[model samples]
Target: MSKPSILSKLNSGVESSSPPMAHPLRQRVPSTAIAGLGRSLDDLAADSVATIDPALIDPSPFGDRLEYDEEATNLLLAAIEAEGQRLPLLVRPHPKIEGRYQLAYGHRRLQVLRILNRKAKAFIRNLTDAELILEQGAENGGREGLTWIERALFAKEMEGQGHPSKTIWTTIGVDKSGLSKMRAVVDTIPDHLIRSIGRAPGIGQPRWQELVDALAIDGAIKRAASILQSKEISSLTSDQKFVGLLRALCGQSSLAPHSGRREIRSSEGRSIARLSSTAKGDVLAIAKAESRFSAWLTEKLPEIYRQFLIEGATSTLDSERPATGAADSDGTMVVISQP
Candidate 1:
C-alpha cells in the first residue's frame, strides 16, 4: 500500500477559513489527527488539526527569537517548495482578537508558507500564555537552537514579564546554576552591543563569560562601542562581527607599559641620541646621528685607543727625567746636557 497524502488527508473535513474566535480564558486540546496520535478517540473529537489561511496567524508576542538566519530560511523555503510541509505548526486561537490564531512554534515555516501564498498546515489548540511560551521554548531548544546570547536575552525578557525564576529556567531548559550564569553574562554586556553583534550561533557560555570579564575593565565599554561602529566591522558576517568585537575587547586589556627613556638633543634641539638606564647597564643609542659620522667613529676606534696608550707612556718618562735645556734665538728649545 502507498502512504497517505498529507494535503488530501488534512483538507478532508476543514474548510480554508479563519479559525473561530475562542473565549479569552478557555483552553482547547489538539483537534488534528496527528495531534491525536497519542490520545483517545474522545480526545480527537475535542481537538484536531486544520489547514488555515496564512494571513490569520499572528506570531507569538512572547516569542524568544530576536533574529532569524536568512540563508537558512531560504533553504527551508526551497525545500518546502519542492516537498510540501512535512511537519505541522502548533497554534492557539487568538486570545483577544476574534477569527485569528497565535503561533507557538514553526515561525519559519509560517513565514515561508505566507510568502508562497499558500495555506498553513497547523495543529489548532487553545493554549494559555504559559503553555504557549513553554512550547516555543521547547521547540527552539530541541531543534535549530538559538545562540547563547539570544537565549540569555530571552530569559531576561521573560523575567521582565513577571515570570518566576523556576518557570524561566524550565522554559529555556536550564537549571538554576546555568540560568544564573546566563543572567550574569547578559547583565554585564550592554543590550545594544549584543544586538549589534547579531545572532552568533555556535558561540557558547565560556566565550561570552570571557567577554563579560573584558568589559569589566575601565574604558573597555567605550572602546568596544567604537569597534562596533567602525566601517570595517559593518561589512562582516554576524559571527565575524562578534569575533571582531571580542578581539578588540581582549586587545584593549593586554597593552604593554611604556619604558622610561629620554632623548638627547643637539645644540639646535634636534634629537641626536637616546639614553636609557636599567639595573643591568646604561645604553647610549646614537642612530639619530649622521650615518657617515657613525661609520668614521667605528673605523677610528682602534687608532684612538693606541694614541691614548702612547700619551700615558710619555707622561711617565717626563716624570722620571730632570729638566736641562738651552734657548736659541728663534725660541726653539733643546736639551743641552744629560745627567
Candidate 2:
C-alpha cells in the first residue's frame, strides 16, 4: 500500500478553527510544515474511536523496548475490539519532526489497537521535553517495575539528560542506601550476569550485585557465567563456594599474612603461576588452579561477555580496573592467582 503523505496524515483539519479552551489539548501540526496543505478536521474521516488503522502510529519515543508477548497482545486486541477505545493514548510531538507525533506513553495499548485495525483513542498534550521523559519513564515502569537492566538504562539516560543520579533515586522511590546498592550493582556486574540476573531463578539484586562486583576482576565474570549456564552451580553449596572462590580471588579485603610472595605469569602459550616455598602447598595448588582457570578464561571470557552485550542484561561490571598491588608477610595463607 502507498504511504500517505506526511502532511495528509498529520495535518487533519482540526486546526482550521481553534476549538474551545476547555479541552486545553487538541491536535496540532507545525505551521510551517503544513502551511500549504489546507486541511480541516471536518474533511478527514473519523471512525467511532474504533476500526482506525493503528499501524500509522509509531513506537514509544522513550525506548523502553518492551518485551511484547503474543498472548498478551492477542488478548488486548480482542478486548479492545470488544470494548472499543476505552482508554486514551498519551503522545507528544516527535523530537525529530515538527509535525509528526511520537508515542510518549500508551505504547502497548497502541500496539493492540493496531492489531485490531482500530483508531487509537488518544489524548493530545503540549508537553515539555522533561514532561515527556518523566511521563514515558513512568509509563514504561508499569506494574512489574523496571528490570535491573531497564533501570540501569533508564538511570543512565536520566543522568545524560542532566538529571542527577540522586533525582533518579528519588524518582524511583528507592532510598539512598538502596539507590547506592543499585548503582554499585549496575556498575560492577558482568553484562551476561546482569542480563540474566532478574530472570535467573532465586537470584536477587543484592546477591547479583555482590557477584557482579566479584566478577569485575579478570575472568571472574566468565567463570561465574559458565558455571551458572551449565547448571553446575544450581545447589546452594555450589553457589556459596563459587561466591567464596570469587571473593578470595577478587575481594579487595586484606589477605592473611604469608611469608611467600605470589607471582602470576600471563603468556600466550599457557598460564604459569609460582609462589614462594613458605606458602603452604595447598595454597600453591589453589594458585595453580586459579592460573589454569585464568588461561581457560582468556580463551572463553570474551564469548561470555558478548552474551551480555547482545542480551542487554542489567548486570554491569565496571570496565575500569585498579592498579596491580599485593602484599605478603610471614604466615600460612591461601592464594588463587590466574595467569
Predicted candidate 1 versus true structure: per-residue lDDT over 112-173, tens digit per residue: 99888888988887787776776676677667468878888888877876788887776676
Task: Evaluate model 1: give its lDDT.
Answer: 0.70
Candidate 2 regions off by >4 Å? 1-53, 70-75, 140-142, 190-203, 221-339
Count backbone clashes in candidate 1: 6
Query: Model 2, 219-327: lDDT tens per residue?
Result: 7666666655544334434334334333344432112232234554543433355544311122333245566555654575466547545765323323122223222
lDDT of each: 0.70, 0.51
- TM-scores of the candidates are 0.57, 0.46
Instruction: Report the C-alpha displacement of residue 95, candidate 1, in angstroms.
Output: 3.7
Among all windows of 10 consecutive residues in model 1, the one with the lowest summed lDDT is 251-260
RMSD in order of candidates: 23.2, 18.6
